[model samples]
Target: MDTGKKVGDLFGRLGKVPGRGVGIGLQLLVGAGGLAYGVSQSMYTVEGGHRAIIFSRLGGVQNEVYAEGLHFRIPWFHYPIIYDIRSRPRSISSPTGSKDLQMVNISLRVLARPDAVALPRIYRQLGTDYDERVLPSICNEVLKSVVAKFNASQLITQRSQVSLLVRKELTERARDFNIILDDVAITELSFGKEYTAAVESKQVAQQEAQRAQFLVEKAKQERQQKIVQAEGEAQAALLLGDAVTKNPGYLKLRKIRAAQSIARTIAQSNNRAYLDANTLMLNLTDLGYDQGATRAGTSKK
Candidate 1:
Protein backbone atom coordinates (compact mmCIF):
# COMPACT_ATOMS: atom_id res chain seq x y z
CA MET A 1 0.00 0.00 0.00
CA ASP A 2 2.91 2.43 0.81
CA THR A 3 4.68 1.77 -2.60
CA GLY A 4 1.38 2.28 -4.41
CA LYS A 5 0.82 5.54 -2.58
CA LYS A 6 4.38 6.78 -3.49
CA VAL A 7 3.86 5.85 -7.18
CA GLY A 8 0.48 7.67 -7.22
CA ASP A 9 2.22 10.70 -5.60
CA LEU A 10 4.88 10.68 -8.44
CA PHE A 11 2.17 10.49 -11.09
CA GLY A 12 0.25 13.30 -9.44
CA ARG A 13 3.41 15.48 -9.47
CA LEU A 14 4.02 14.78 -13.15
CA GLY A 15 0.42 15.70 -13.99
CA LYS A 16 0.59 18.78 -11.82
CA VAL A 17 3.60 20.14 -13.85
CA PRO A 18 1.76 22.85 -15.81
CA GLY A 19 1.31 22.37 -19.49
CA ARG A 20 4.01 19.69 -20.02
CA GLY A 21 2.48 18.52 -23.34
CA VAL A 22 2.26 22.15 -24.51
CA GLY A 23 5.98 22.59 -23.68
CA ILE A 24 6.84 19.54 -25.81
CA GLY A 25 4.62 20.88 -28.65
CA LEU A 26 6.34 24.28 -28.48
CA GLN A 27 9.81 22.65 -28.87
CA LEU A 28 8.61 20.72 -31.90
CA LEU A 29 7.13 23.92 -33.36
CA VAL A 30 10.50 25.77 -32.96
CA GLY A 31 12.30 22.92 -34.71
CA ALA A 32 9.79 22.94 -37.58
CA GLY A 33 10.13 26.74 -37.93
CA GLY A 34 13.90 26.44 -38.26
CA LEU A 35 13.57 23.73 -40.92
CA ALA A 36 11.08 25.81 -42.86
CA TYR A 37 13.42 28.85 -42.67
CA GLY A 38 16.31 26.74 -44.01
CA VAL A 39 14.19 25.38 -46.88
CA SER A 40 13.11 28.89 -47.79
CA GLN A 41 16.73 30.00 -47.81
CA SER A 42 17.65 27.17 -50.17
CA MET A 43 15.11 28.23 -52.79
CA TYR A 44 15.69 31.20 -55.15
CA THR A 45 13.94 32.80 -58.07
CA VAL A 46 15.88 34.08 -61.06
CA GLU A 47 14.17 36.96 -62.80
CA GLY A 48 13.78 37.59 -66.49
CA GLY A 49 16.79 38.45 -68.62
CA HIS A 50 18.99 36.84 -65.98
CA ARG A 51 20.71 33.48 -65.42
CA ALA A 52 22.11 32.03 -62.23
CA ILE A 53 25.31 30.11 -61.69
CA ILE A 54 25.55 27.84 -58.69
CA PHE A 55 28.63 27.69 -56.52
CA SER A 56 29.16 24.69 -54.29
CA ARG A 57 31.14 25.09 -51.10
CA LEU A 58 32.74 21.66 -51.39
CA GLY A 59 32.65 21.00 -55.13
CA GLY A 60 33.30 24.49 -56.55
CA VAL A 61 31.30 25.85 -59.51
CA GLN A 62 28.65 23.51 -60.86
CA ASN A 63 28.24 22.80 -64.54
CA GLU A 64 24.47 23.28 -64.38
CA VAL A 65 23.12 26.82 -64.73
CA TYR A 66 19.65 27.97 -63.70
CA ALA A 67 17.38 29.80 -66.09
CA GLU A 68 14.83 32.42 -65.12
CA GLY A 69 12.50 30.87 -62.51
CA LEU A 70 12.45 29.26 -59.09
CA HIS A 71 15.36 26.99 -58.19
CA PHE A 72 16.34 24.83 -55.21
CA ARG A 73 19.69 24.14 -53.60
CA ILE A 74 21.27 22.97 -50.39
CA PRO A 75 20.96 25.53 -47.63
CA TRP A 76 24.15 27.44 -46.70
CA PHE A 77 26.26 25.25 -49.04
CA HIS A 78 25.04 26.23 -52.50
CA TYR A 79 24.46 29.82 -53.65
CA PRO A 80 23.25 31.34 -56.90
CA ILE A 81 25.13 34.15 -58.57
CA ILE A 82 22.89 35.88 -61.05
CA TYR A 83 24.17 37.38 -64.26
CA ASP A 84 22.39 39.59 -66.73
CA ILE A 85 22.39 38.09 -70.22
CA ARG A 86 20.94 41.12 -71.95
CA SER A 87 22.72 42.88 -74.76
CA ARG A 88 24.59 45.93 -73.57
CA PRO A 89 26.01 48.93 -75.40
CA ARG A 90 29.42 50.39 -74.78
CA SER A 91 30.96 53.45 -76.41
CA ILE A 92 34.67 54.02 -76.60
CA SER A 93 36.74 56.89 -77.92
CA SER A 94 40.06 55.71 -79.24
CA PRO A 95 42.88 57.84 -80.56
CA THR A 96 45.00 55.99 -83.06
CA GLY A 97 47.59 56.42 -85.80
CA SER A 98 46.64 56.04 -89.44
CA LYS A 99 48.78 54.47 -92.11
CA ASP A 100 49.82 57.99 -93.11
CA LEU A 101 50.84 58.60 -89.50
CA GLN A 102 48.00 61.03 -88.95
CA MET A 103 46.32 61.31 -85.57
CA VAL A 104 42.73 60.06 -85.83
CA ASN A 105 40.09 60.32 -83.15
CA ILE A 106 37.52 57.57 -83.49
CA SER A 107 34.29 57.19 -81.55
CA LEU A 108 32.80 53.74 -81.68
CA ARG A 109 29.88 51.84 -80.25
CA VAL A 110 29.93 48.11 -79.44
CA LEU A 111 26.91 45.92 -78.76
CA ALA A 112 27.83 42.81 -76.84
CA ARG A 113 26.53 40.04 -74.60
CA PRO A 114 27.90 36.99 -72.90
CA ASP A 115 27.51 33.61 -74.57
CA ALA A 116 24.63 31.92 -72.80
CA VAL A 117 26.10 28.47 -73.34
CA ALA A 118 29.49 29.60 -72.07
CA LEU A 119 28.26 31.73 -69.18
CA PRO A 120 29.87 29.45 -66.63
CA ARG A 121 33.19 29.63 -68.35
CA ILE A 122 32.90 33.39 -68.67
CA TYR A 123 32.11 33.75 -65.00
CA ARG A 124 35.08 31.59 -64.10
CA GLN A 125 37.39 33.59 -66.31
CA LEU A 126 36.11 37.15 -66.18
CA GLY A 127 33.48 37.29 -63.44
CA THR A 128 30.46 39.58 -63.55
CA ASP A 129 32.36 42.58 -64.88
CA TYR A 130 33.45 40.72 -67.98
CA ASP A 131 32.70 43.62 -70.29
CA GLU A 132 34.74 46.00 -68.25
CA ARG A 133 37.62 43.57 -68.04
CA VAL A 134 37.80 42.38 -71.65
CA LEU A 135 35.87 44.39 -74.19
CA PRO A 136 37.34 47.90 -73.99
CA SER A 137 40.91 46.71 -74.27
CA ILE A 138 40.14 44.33 -77.10
CA CYS A 139 38.17 46.96 -78.97
CA ASN A 140 40.97 49.49 -78.58
CA GLU A 141 43.56 47.06 -79.84
CA VAL A 142 41.53 45.95 -82.84
CA LEU A 143 40.50 49.48 -83.74
CA LYS A 144 44.07 50.70 -83.64
CA SER A 145 45.23 47.75 -85.70
CA VAL A 146 42.58 48.41 -88.34
CA VAL A 147 43.16 52.17 -88.26
CA ALA A 148 46.85 51.61 -88.85
CA LYS A 149 46.01 49.88 -92.10
CA PHE A 150 44.11 52.87 -93.54
CA ASN A 151 45.02 56.48 -94.23
CA ALA A 152 43.20 59.40 -92.67
CA SER A 153 41.19 60.07 -95.85
CA GLN A 154 40.40 56.40 -96.11
CA LEU A 155 38.98 56.50 -92.63
CA ILE A 156 36.47 59.07 -93.84
CA THR A 157 35.65 57.45 -97.18
CA GLN A 158 35.89 53.81 -96.12
CA ARG A 159 34.34 54.19 -92.72
CA SER A 160 31.96 51.28 -93.22
CA GLN A 161 34.78 49.01 -94.33
CA VAL A 162 36.92 50.03 -91.40
CA SER A 163 34.03 49.32 -89.06
CA LEU A 164 33.56 45.89 -90.64
CA LEU A 165 37.19 44.96 -90.21
CA VAL A 166 37.22 46.13 -86.64
CA ARG A 167 34.05 44.19 -85.91
CA LYS A 168 35.53 41.04 -87.38
CA GLU A 169 38.73 41.31 -85.42
CA LEU A 170 36.91 42.25 -82.24
CA THR A 171 34.45 39.41 -82.60
CA GLU A 172 37.24 36.87 -83.01
CA ARG A 173 39.10 38.26 -80.04
CA ALA A 174 35.98 38.43 -77.90
CA ARG A 175 35.20 34.81 -78.67
CA ASP A 176 38.42 33.89 -76.92
CA PHE A 177 36.89 35.34 -73.74
CA ASN A 178 33.39 33.86 -74.27
CA ILE A 179 31.73 37.06 -75.38
CA ILE A 180 29.38 37.63 -78.32
CA LEU A 181 29.88 40.78 -80.33
CA ASP A 182 26.61 41.74 -81.92
CA ASP A 183 27.54 44.88 -83.80
CA VAL A 184 30.17 47.56 -84.06
CA ALA A 185 29.76 51.05 -85.48
CA ILE A 186 32.12 53.93 -86.06
CA THR A 187 30.15 56.84 -84.74
CA GLU A 188 32.59 59.60 -85.57
CA LEU A 189 35.99 60.12 -87.11
CA SER A 190 38.03 63.29 -86.90
CA PHE A 191 41.46 64.48 -87.88
CA GLY A 192 43.64 67.39 -86.87
CA LYS A 193 42.52 70.96 -87.73
CA GLU A 194 45.31 71.33 -90.26
CA TYR A 195 44.30 68.21 -92.08
CA THR A 196 40.68 69.29 -92.25
CA ALA A 197 41.67 72.69 -93.57
CA ALA A 198 43.81 71.08 -96.24
CA VAL A 199 40.95 68.83 -97.36
CA GLU A 200 38.63 71.81 -97.62
CA SER A 201 41.16 73.71 -99.66
CA LYS A 202 41.58 70.81 -102.06
CA GLN A 203 37.84 70.56 -102.59
CA VAL A 204 37.58 74.28 -103.26
CA ALA A 205 40.38 74.10 -105.80
CA GLN A 206 38.72 71.19 -107.60
CA GLN A 207 35.44 73.11 -107.83
CA GLU A 208 37.24 76.13 -109.26
CA ALA A 209 38.96 73.95 -111.83
CA GLN A 210 35.65 72.44 -112.91
CA ARG A 211 34.12 75.91 -113.29
CA ALA A 212 37.05 77.11 -115.40
CA GLN A 213 36.82 74.02 -117.61
CA PHE A 214 33.13 74.68 -118.15
CA LEU A 215 33.81 78.30 -119.14
CA VAL A 216 36.49 77.20 -121.62
CA GLU A 217 34.14 74.68 -123.22
CA LYS A 218 31.40 77.33 -123.54
CA ALA A 219 33.81 79.76 -125.30
CA LYS A 220 34.89 77.02 -127.68
CA GLN A 221 31.28 76.22 -128.54
CA GLU A 222 30.49 79.89 -129.32
CA ARG A 223 33.59 80.17 -131.53
CA GLN A 224 32.61 76.99 -133.37
CA GLN A 225 29.07 78.30 -134.00
CA LYS A 226 30.41 81.63 -135.44
CA ILE A 227 32.85 79.81 -137.70
CA VAL A 228 30.08 77.53 -139.02
CA GLN A 229 27.83 80.56 -139.77
CA ALA A 230 30.61 82.37 -141.68
CA GLU A 231 31.36 79.24 -143.75
CA GLY A 232 27.68 78.82 -144.66
CA GLU A 233 27.40 82.47 -145.77
CA ALA A 234 30.59 82.19 -147.90
CA GLN A 235 29.35 79.00 -149.59
CA ALA A 236 26.01 80.69 -150.41
CA ALA A 237 27.79 83.71 -152.02
CA LEU A 238 30.00 81.46 -154.12
CA LEU A 239 26.97 79.46 -155.39
CA LEU A 240 25.29 82.73 -156.38
CA GLY A 241 28.38 83.91 -158.33
CA ASP A 242 28.62 80.55 -160.19
CA ALA A 243 24.90 80.70 -161.12
CA VAL A 244 25.44 84.23 -162.61
CA THR A 245 28.48 83.03 -164.64
CA LYS A 246 26.57 80.06 -166.12
CA ASN A 247 23.75 82.19 -167.57
CA PRO A 248 24.24 85.85 -168.58
CA GLY A 249 20.49 86.28 -169.41
CA TYR A 250 19.69 85.44 -165.74
CA LEU A 251 20.80 88.98 -164.76
CA LYS A 252 18.49 90.54 -167.37
CA LEU A 253 15.58 88.40 -166.10
CA ARG A 254 16.27 89.49 -162.52
CA LYS A 255 16.32 93.16 -163.58
CA ILE A 256 12.91 92.77 -165.25
CA ARG A 257 11.42 91.12 -162.18
CA ALA A 258 12.77 93.90 -159.96
CA ALA A 259 11.26 96.54 -162.29
CA GLN A 260 7.87 94.80 -162.27
CA SER A 261 8.00 94.59 -158.43
CA ILE A 262 8.71 98.36 -158.29
CA ALA A 263 5.82 99.13 -160.66
CA ARG A 264 3.40 97.12 -158.43
CA THR A 265 4.70 98.94 -155.31
CA ILE A 266 4.29 102.39 -156.99
CA ALA A 267 0.74 101.54 -158.10
CA GLN A 268 -0.28 100.49 -154.55
CA SER A 269 1.03 103.73 -152.94
CA ASN A 270 -1.45 106.35 -151.59
CA ASN A 271 0.21 109.20 -153.48
CA ARG A 272 -0.89 109.52 -157.14
CA ALA A 273 1.68 110.33 -159.86
CA TYR A 274 0.65 112.91 -162.47
CA LEU A 275 2.31 110.76 -165.25
CA ASP A 276 0.15 109.34 -168.08
CA ALA A 277 -0.11 105.60 -168.98
CA ASN A 278 2.05 106.21 -172.08
CA THR A 279 4.89 107.59 -169.94
CA LEU A 280 4.75 104.54 -167.70
CA MET A 281 5.01 102.19 -170.70
CA LEU A 282 7.98 104.18 -172.05
CA ASN A 283 9.79 103.89 -168.72
CA LEU A 284 9.52 100.03 -168.93
CA THR A 285 12.52 99.99 -171.40
CA ASP A 286 14.80 100.92 -168.54
CA LEU A 287 14.21 97.45 -167.10
CA GLY A 288 14.83 94.84 -169.92
CA TYR A 289 11.93 95.39 -172.34
CA ASP A 290 14.27 96.57 -175.15
CA GLN A 291 16.57 93.54 -174.78
CA GLY A 292 13.62 91.12 -174.93
CA ALA A 293 12.30 92.89 -178.07
CA THR A 294 15.71 92.54 -179.83
CA ARG A 295 15.92 88.82 -178.98
CA ALA A 296 12.42 88.23 -180.41
CA GLY A 297 13.22 90.13 -183.65
CA THR A 298 16.45 88.12 -184.26
CA SER A 299 14.71 84.81 -183.61
CA LYS A 300 11.90 85.65 -186.06
CA LYS A 301 14.42 86.45 -188.88
Candidate 2:
Protein backbone atom coordinates (compact mmCIF):
# COMPACT_ATOMS: atom_id res chain seq x y z
CA MET A 1 0.00 0.00 0.00
CA ASP A 2 1.32 3.55 -0.91
CA THR A 3 1.16 6.49 1.42
CA GLY A 4 -1.06 9.61 0.54
CA LYS A 5 1.85 12.05 -0.19
CA LYS A 6 3.44 9.38 -2.40
CA VAL A 7 0.19 8.97 -4.37
CA GLY A 8 0.00 12.78 -4.93
CA ASP A 9 3.63 12.79 -6.09
CA LEU A 10 2.97 9.90 -8.52
CA PHE A 11 -0.03 11.76 -10.02
CA GLY A 12 2.22 14.79 -10.54
CA ARG A 13 4.79 12.66 -12.42
CA LEU A 14 2.09 11.18 -14.73
CA GLY A 15 0.85 14.71 -15.61
CA LYS A 16 4.39 15.83 -16.53
CA VAL A 17 4.81 12.81 -18.93
CA PRO A 18 1.76 13.84 -20.93
CA GLY A 19 2.96 17.47 -21.04
CA ARG A 20 6.34 16.35 -22.47
CA GLY A 21 4.58 14.35 -25.19
CA VAL A 22 2.44 17.41 -26.17
CA GLY A 23 5.55 19.64 -26.41
CA ILE A 24 7.37 17.16 -28.69
CA GLY A 25 4.29 16.93 -30.96
CA LEU A 26 4.16 20.75 -31.21
CA GLN A 27 7.84 20.81 -32.24
CA LEU A 28 7.22 18.29 -35.03
CA LEU A 29 4.30 20.36 -36.40
CA VAL A 30 6.42 23.52 -36.41
CA GLY A 31 9.20 21.74 -38.31
CA ALA A 32 6.72 20.52 -40.95
CA GLY A 33 5.31 24.06 -41.43
CA GLY A 34 8.82 25.43 -41.94
CA LEU A 35 9.62 22.79 -44.55
CA ALA A 36 6.43 23.60 -46.52
CA TYR A 37 7.32 27.30 -46.53
CA GLY A 38 10.80 26.57 -47.91
CA VAL A 39 9.48 24.27 -50.65
CA SER A 40 6.97 26.90 -51.83
CA GLN A 41 9.72 29.49 -51.97
CA SER A 42 12.13 27.37 -54.05
CA MET A 43 9.59 26.29 -56.72
CA TYR A 44 7.29 28.21 -59.09
CA THR A 45 4.89 27.58 -61.96
CA VAL A 46 5.05 29.41 -65.29
CA GLU A 47 1.48 29.90 -66.51
CA GLY A 48 0.34 30.20 -70.11
CA GLY A 49 1.81 33.11 -72.08
CA HIS A 50 4.64 33.53 -69.57
CA ARG A 51 8.36 32.61 -69.56
CA ALA A 52 11.04 32.44 -66.83
CA ILE A 53 14.76 33.07 -66.75
CA ILE A 54 17.19 32.08 -64.01
CA PHE A 55 19.94 34.26 -62.56
CA SER A 56 22.74 32.77 -60.43
CA ARG A 57 24.87 34.56 -57.85
CA LEU A 58 28.01 33.14 -59.45
CA GLY A 59 26.69 33.69 -63.02
CA GLY A 60 24.96 36.87 -64.22
CA VAL A 61 22.05 35.41 -66.27
CA GLN A 62 21.53 31.87 -67.54
CA ASN A 63 20.53 31.31 -71.13
CA GLU A 64 18.11 28.39 -70.53
CA VAL A 65 14.58 29.79 -70.91
CA TYR A 66 11.87 27.93 -68.91
CA ALA A 67 8.51 27.11 -70.45
CA GLU A 68 5.23 26.51 -68.63
CA GLY A 69 5.39 23.98 -65.74
CA LEU A 70 7.05 23.37 -62.38
CA HIS A 71 10.52 24.89 -62.04
CA PHE A 72 12.97 25.01 -59.14
CA ARG A 73 15.62 27.49 -58.05
CA ILE A 74 17.95 27.45 -55.05
CA PRO A 75 16.46 29.39 -52.14
CA TRP A 76 18.28 32.83 -52.11
CA PHE A 77 21.05 31.65 -54.46
CA HIS A 78 19.15 31.64 -57.76
CA TYR A 79 16.53 34.22 -58.79
CA PRO A 80 13.75 33.48 -61.30
CA ILE A 81 12.81 36.38 -63.52
CA ILE A 82 9.39 35.98 -65.12
CA TYR A 83 8.10 37.80 -68.16
CA ASP A 84 4.80 37.77 -70.05
CA ILE A 85 5.55 36.51 -73.54
CA ARG A 86 2.30 37.61 -75.14
CA SER A 87 1.44 39.73 -78.17
CA ARG A 88 0.40 43.21 -77.05
CA PRO A 89 -0.89 46.13 -79.06
CA ARG A 90 0.79 49.53 -78.70
CA SER A 91 0.14 52.87 -80.40
CA ILE A 92 2.56 55.70 -81.09
CA SER A 93 1.57 59.11 -82.35
CA SER A 94 3.51 62.21 -83.32
CA PRO A 95 3.40 65.38 -85.39
CA THR A 96 5.81 65.56 -88.29
CA GLY A 97 6.49 67.77 -91.29
CA SER A 98 5.82 66.28 -94.70
CA LYS A 99 8.08 66.65 -97.74
CA ASP A 100 6.04 69.62 -98.95
CA LEU A 101 6.49 71.32 -95.56
CA GLN A 102 2.96 70.54 -94.44
CA MET A 103 2.24 69.94 -90.75
CA VAL A 104 0.75 66.48 -90.37
CA ASN A 105 -0.46 64.27 -87.53
CA ILE A 106 0.25 60.54 -87.69
CA SER A 107 -0.58 57.51 -85.56
CA LEU A 108 1.00 54.05 -85.71
CA ARG A 109 -0.25 50.75 -84.21
CA VAL A 110 1.99 47.74 -83.60
CA LEU A 111 1.68 44.22 -82.19
CA ALA A 112 4.84 43.47 -80.20
CA ARG A 113 6.16 40.31 -78.53
CA PRO A 114 9.48 39.41 -76.96
CA ASP A 115 11.60 36.79 -78.68
CA ALA A 116 11.39 33.56 -76.64
CA VAL A 117 14.93 32.48 -77.36
CA ALA A 118 16.29 35.93 -76.66
CA LEU A 119 14.64 36.14 -73.25
CA PRO A 120 17.96 35.98 -71.38
CA ARG A 121 19.53 38.72 -73.46
CA ILE A 122 16.43 40.85 -73.22
CA TYR A 123 16.33 40.50 -69.46
CA ARG A 124 19.97 41.45 -69.17
CA GLN A 125 19.58 44.51 -71.38
CA LEU A 126 15.98 45.82 -71.22
CA GLY A 127 14.43 43.84 -68.29
CA THR A 128 10.72 43.01 -67.63
CA ASP A 129 9.13 46.09 -69.24
CA TYR A 130 11.19 45.74 -72.39
CA ASP A 131 8.43 46.58 -74.85
CA GLU A 132 7.87 49.93 -73.18
CA ARG A 133 11.51 50.85 -73.64
CA VAL A 134 11.91 49.53 -77.16
CA LEU A 135 8.72 50.26 -79.11
CA PRO A 136 8.15 53.99 -78.72
CA SER A 137 11.69 55.13 -79.58
CA ILE A 138 11.95 53.13 -82.82
CA CYS A 139 8.37 53.80 -83.87
CA ASN A 140 8.81 57.56 -83.51
CA GLU A 141 11.94 57.44 -85.60
CA VAL A 142 10.33 55.39 -88.36
CA LEU A 143 7.22 57.61 -88.59
CA LYS A 144 9.16 60.84 -88.81
CA SER A 145 11.56 59.48 -91.44
CA VAL A 146 8.89 57.91 -93.63
CA VAL A 147 6.52 60.87 -93.45
CA ALA A 148 9.28 63.22 -94.48
CA LYS A 149 9.60 61.47 -97.86
CA PHE A 150 6.02 62.08 -99.00
CA ASN A 151 3.89 65.19 -99.60
CA ALA A 152 0.68 65.83 -97.66
CA SER A 153 -1.45 64.97 -100.71
CA GLN A 154 0.60 61.86 -101.35
CA LEU A 155 0.04 60.76 -97.79
CA ILE A 156 -3.69 60.65 -98.51
CA THR A 157 -3.55 59.27 -102.09
CA GLN A 158 -0.62 56.86 -101.71
CA ARG A 159 -1.58 55.83 -98.18
CA SER A 160 -1.17 52.13 -98.94
CA GLN A 161 2.39 52.59 -100.14
CA VAL A 162 3.14 54.71 -97.09
CA SER A 163 1.83 52.03 -94.73
CA LEU A 164 3.88 49.39 -96.50
CA LEU A 165 7.05 51.35 -96.15
CA VAL A 166 6.36 52.04 -92.48
CA ARG A 167 5.67 48.34 -91.80
CA LYS A 168 8.80 47.20 -93.58
CA GLU A 169 11.12 49.62 -91.82
CA LEU A 170 9.57 49.26 -88.37
CA THR A 171 9.68 45.47 -88.53
CA GLU A 172 13.35 45.52 -89.41
CA ARG A 173 14.20 48.00 -86.67
CA ALA A 174 12.31 46.09 -83.96
CA ARG A 175 14.13 42.89 -84.85
CA ASP A 176 17.44 44.48 -83.93
CA PHE A 177 16.35 44.96 -80.30
CA ASN A 178 15.18 41.35 -79.61
CA ILE A 179 11.56 42.26 -80.19
CA ILE A 180 9.20 40.83 -82.81
CA LEU A 181 6.55 43.06 -84.40
CA ASP A 182 3.77 40.98 -85.95
CA ASP A 183 2.13 43.93 -87.70
CA VAL A 184 2.49 47.69 -88.15
CA ALA A 185 -0.05 50.10 -89.66
CA ILE A 186 -0.88 53.76 -89.92
CA THR A 187 -4.00 54.16 -87.86
CA GLU A 188 -4.65 57.89 -88.37
CA LEU A 189 -3.54 60.70 -90.64
CA SER A 190 -4.59 64.35 -90.90
CA PHE A 191 -3.39 67.66 -92.25
CA GLY A 192 -3.57 71.28 -91.21
CA LYS A 193 -6.85 73.26 -91.58
CA GLU A 194 -5.38 75.70 -94.08
CA TYR A 195 -4.46 72.94 -96.50
CA THR A 196 -7.95 71.46 -96.34
CA ALA A 197 -9.53 74.83 -97.13
CA ALA A 198 -7.15 75.29 -100.05
CA VAL A 199 -8.19 71.96 -101.53
CA GLU A 200 -11.84 72.92 -101.27
CA SER A 201 -11.20 76.22 -103.05
CA LYS A 202 -9.36 74.47 -105.88
CA GLN A 203 -12.28 72.09 -106.46
CA VAL A 204 -14.73 75.04 -106.56
CA ALA A 205 -12.58 76.84 -109.10
CA GLN A 206 -12.45 73.78 -111.32
CA GLN A 207 -16.26 73.48 -111.29
CA GLU A 208 -16.69 77.17 -112.21
CA ALA A 209 -14.23 76.82 -115.12
CA GLN A 210 -16.13 73.79 -116.43
CA ARG A 211 -19.43 75.74 -116.31
CA ALA A 212 -17.92 78.64 -118.27
CA GLN A 213 -16.58 76.31 -120.95
CA PHE A 214 -20.05 74.74 -121.37
CA LEU A 215 -21.66 78.22 -121.80
CA VAL A 216 -19.10 79.16 -124.48
CA GLU A 217 -19.76 75.98 -126.42
CA LYS A 218 -23.53 76.65 -126.25
CA ALA A 219 -23.07 80.17 -127.66
CA LYS A 220 -21.04 78.79 -130.61
CA GLN A 221 -23.81 76.28 -131.39
CA GLU A 222 -26.42 79.09 -131.33
CA ARG A 223 -24.36 81.19 -133.79
CA GLN A 224 -24.13 78.25 -136.14
CA GLN A 225 -27.93 77.79 -135.99
CA LYS A 226 -28.58 81.52 -136.96
CA ILE A 227 -26.13 81.35 -139.89
CA VAL A 228 -27.79 78.15 -141.17
CA GLN A 229 -31.27 79.79 -140.99
CA ALA A 230 -30.14 82.90 -142.97
CA GLU A 231 -28.45 80.76 -145.68
CA GLY A 232 -31.61 78.64 -146.11
CA GLU A 233 -33.89 81.71 -146.51
CA ALA A 234 -31.53 83.37 -149.09
CA GLN A 235 -31.32 80.16 -151.15
CA ALA A 236 -35.16 79.80 -151.20
CA ALA A 237 -35.59 83.44 -152.39
CA LEU A 238 -33.02 83.01 -155.23
CA LEU A 239 -34.76 79.82 -156.45
CA LEU A 240 -38.17 81.62 -156.47
CA GLY A 241 -36.73 84.51 -158.52
CA ASP A 242 -35.29 82.10 -161.11
CA ALA A 243 -38.62 80.31 -161.42
CA VAL A 244 -40.47 83.62 -162.04
CA THR A 245 -37.95 84.62 -164.81
CA LYS A 246 -38.34 81.26 -166.69
CA ASN A 247 -42.19 81.15 -166.63
CA PRO A 248 -44.13 84.37 -167.51
CA GLY A 249 -47.48 82.66 -166.81
CA TYR A 250 -46.36 82.10 -163.16
CA LEU A 251 -47.00 85.85 -162.48
CA LYS A 252 -50.61 85.57 -163.62
CA LEU A 253 -51.20 82.50 -161.50
CA ARG A 254 -49.70 84.30 -158.45
CA LYS A 255 -52.02 87.28 -159.11
CA ILE A 256 -55.08 84.99 -159.27
CA ARG A 257 -54.09 83.27 -155.97
CA ALA A 258 -53.60 86.72 -154.30
CA ALA A 259 -57.06 87.84 -155.52
CA GLN A 260 -58.75 84.70 -154.14
CA SER A 261 -56.99 85.17 -150.71
CA ILE A 262 -58.08 88.88 -150.62
CA ALA A 263 -61.71 88.01 -151.45
CA ARG A 264 -61.84 85.34 -148.72
CA THR A 265 -60.41 87.81 -146.11
CA ILE A 266 -62.85 90.57 -147.17
CA ALA A 267 -65.84 88.22 -146.98
CA GLN A 268 -64.90 87.18 -143.39
CA SER A 269 -64.46 90.86 -142.25
CA ASN A 270 -67.45 93.00 -140.98
CA ASN A 271 -66.12 96.30 -142.47
CA ARG A 272 -66.63 97.38 -146.10
CA ALA A 273 -63.46 97.32 -148.24
CA TYR A 274 -63.32 99.32 -151.59
CA LEU A 275 -60.34 97.95 -153.65
CA ASP A 276 -58.85 99.91 -156.69
CA ALA A 277 -58.77 98.25 -160.15
CA ASN A 278 -54.96 98.65 -160.35
CA THR A 279 -54.40 97.03 -156.91
CA LEU A 280 -52.39 93.82 -156.97
CA MET A 281 -55.31 91.75 -155.56
CA LEU A 282 -57.97 93.29 -158.01
CA ASN A 283 -55.95 93.75 -161.33
CA LEU A 284 -57.62 91.66 -164.13
CA THR A 285 -56.40 93.36 -167.44
CA ASP A 286 -53.59 91.62 -169.42
CA LEU A 287 -50.91 93.29 -171.68
CA GLY A 288 -52.30 91.42 -174.77
CA TYR A 289 -55.81 92.77 -174.05
CA ASP A 290 -54.48 96.30 -173.82
CA GLN A 291 -52.66 95.98 -177.21
CA GLY A 292 -55.86 94.67 -178.92
CA ALA A 293 -57.88 97.62 -177.58
CA THR A 294 -55.30 100.12 -178.92
CA ARG A 295 -55.23 98.49 -182.42
CA ALA A 296 -59.04 98.63 -182.70
CA GLY A 297 -59.04 102.31 -181.72
CA THR A 298 -56.40 103.14 -184.39
CA SER A 299 -58.33 101.22 -187.13
CA LYS A 300 -61.55 103.01 -186.24
CA LYS A 301 -59.74 106.35 -186.44
Q: Pick the candidate with the highest lDDT.
A: 2
lDDT tens readout by residue for model 2, 102-142: 99999999999999999999988898899889898999899
Question: For residues 253-283, what per-residue lDDT tens digits would candidate 1 score against the true structure?
Answer: 7666776776787899999766553444434
- Which 10-residue span in candidate 2 carries the lowest summed lDDT? 292-301
TM-score for each prediction? 0.70, 0.72
Q: Cα miss at 56, model 1 (Å)?
A: 2.6
- Clash-forming residue pairs, model 2: none
RMSD of 2: 8.9
> What ranges in model 2 sit over 4 Å off?
1-9, 225-301
lDDT for model 1, please.
Answer: 0.85
- For model 1, the superposed segments whose C-alpha errors exceed 4 Å read 1-32, 240-301
Model 1, total clashes = 0
